[model samples]
Target: MPKLSVVMISMNEEKAVGSVIDSIQEVVPDAEILIVDSSTDKTAEIATEKGAKVIRQYPPCGYGRAMELALKSASGDVIVTMDCDATYPSKDIPKLVLLIDQGYDLVNTTRVLTKPKYMPLGNFIGNRVFALCTRIRHGIKTTDVHSGMRAYKRTLIHALKWNPDGPALPVELLIKSVRHGYKFIEIPIDYYERIGNTTLNKLSSTVWTFKRIFCKEYFD
Candidate 1:
């Protein structure tokens, strides 16, 4: 079996991090768990107790930087990235791995199968608009451009040169993957309300995403 590494970036997600790790372990027992935590709470301690290799990401960092740190430290053949707030279901991991096994270069899990009431109306609209813009601009058809849950071969990381230092990382990844001609797949996955305060600044994030999209900096 190919080694699987589950990586998460956490920020003060003490309440949900442990449960997230446990759920992933239940689904992929032998999978390696890695956490890049910049939490000021007990998130790091809890993750360590749950058997996840915890790497402390210092302050003054963004989600992309944390993700990059975890990606660099991951040792598995396949790397699965998910949220630490329990909004993403680890049970869907097998589906992603299966796609990777079938030779897909990158697999994204979409929550568009069913709209959850907990999701903000602004987020729903923004995501759809961004997805449409991505398709029109780059010829990449993704239903959920901001979906956090995704799986990909570790080697795919080397084929892309662009890396954003903020929340725009996911969009950058998808854009670069398309530009590089990597096979991409999106599957619907279960989504839930997050357990803690969301750190996302919807306005700023959306603006940054559009800026990057228009500037075509993702090609850099």
Candidate 2:
């Protein structure tokens, strides 16, 4: 069996990290947890107690850069990534790993069908619009381009050659994966709102994100 590594990127997530780790631990007891945290709180300390290897990221760094650092530090053949906040069900991790073992290059978790409550309306609009853009530009129809929950095989990760190094990295991942002929699919997964503060300022970040992804996908 291929080893699975669960990687999470977070900052000041002391409130939700424990539950997220606990849930993933329940599903994949043998799976290793690697946390890349930049929290000023006790996030890293708490993560270590929960049996996760913690790597502290510096401030002024984007989520994409932190995730890149986390992924590079991972030691498993199959990697599953999610936010440090307990918005995604770690219990569904095995499902993603199973799909990967069956040979899918990338497995995306979609909350669209799951109909998670408390999700921002702006997020819904942004997700649908971005999904449409990705389909039209890359011929890949994905239910959740903004979803933080994703599983990917190590080989496919290399094939994409992604280096966005910013928050728009997930979008880059899907686009490059499709461009490289890698197989990708979406599976329904439960979603929830975060327990603590959110990193995004919806209206402002949405505009910025749209510009960033549009330039990378269409112009550049």
Highest TM-score scorer = 1
The Cα error of candidate 1 at residue 147, in Å, is 0.7
Q: Which stretches of candidate 1 lie over 4 Å from their true place?
A: none
For residues 1-220, what per-residue lDDT tens digits would candidate 2 score against the true structure? 7999999998899999988899889989998899989889989988999999998886738777888887788889999999998889888898999999998999998887534686777677677787777777667778677788999898876555666444667777766676677888899887777889988756654654566456665223
Counting clashing residue pairs in each candidate, in order, gives 0, 0
Candidate 1 C-alpha error for residue 164, in Å? 2.8
Please give the CA lDDT of all the candidate structures. Answer: 0.85, 0.81
Scored against the true structure, residue 62 in model 2 reaches a CA lDDT of 74
Give the Cα-based TM-score of candidate 2 against the true structure.
0.92
Write candidate 1's Cα lDDT for 27-86 as tens digits: 999999999999899999999998999999788398788988887789998999999999
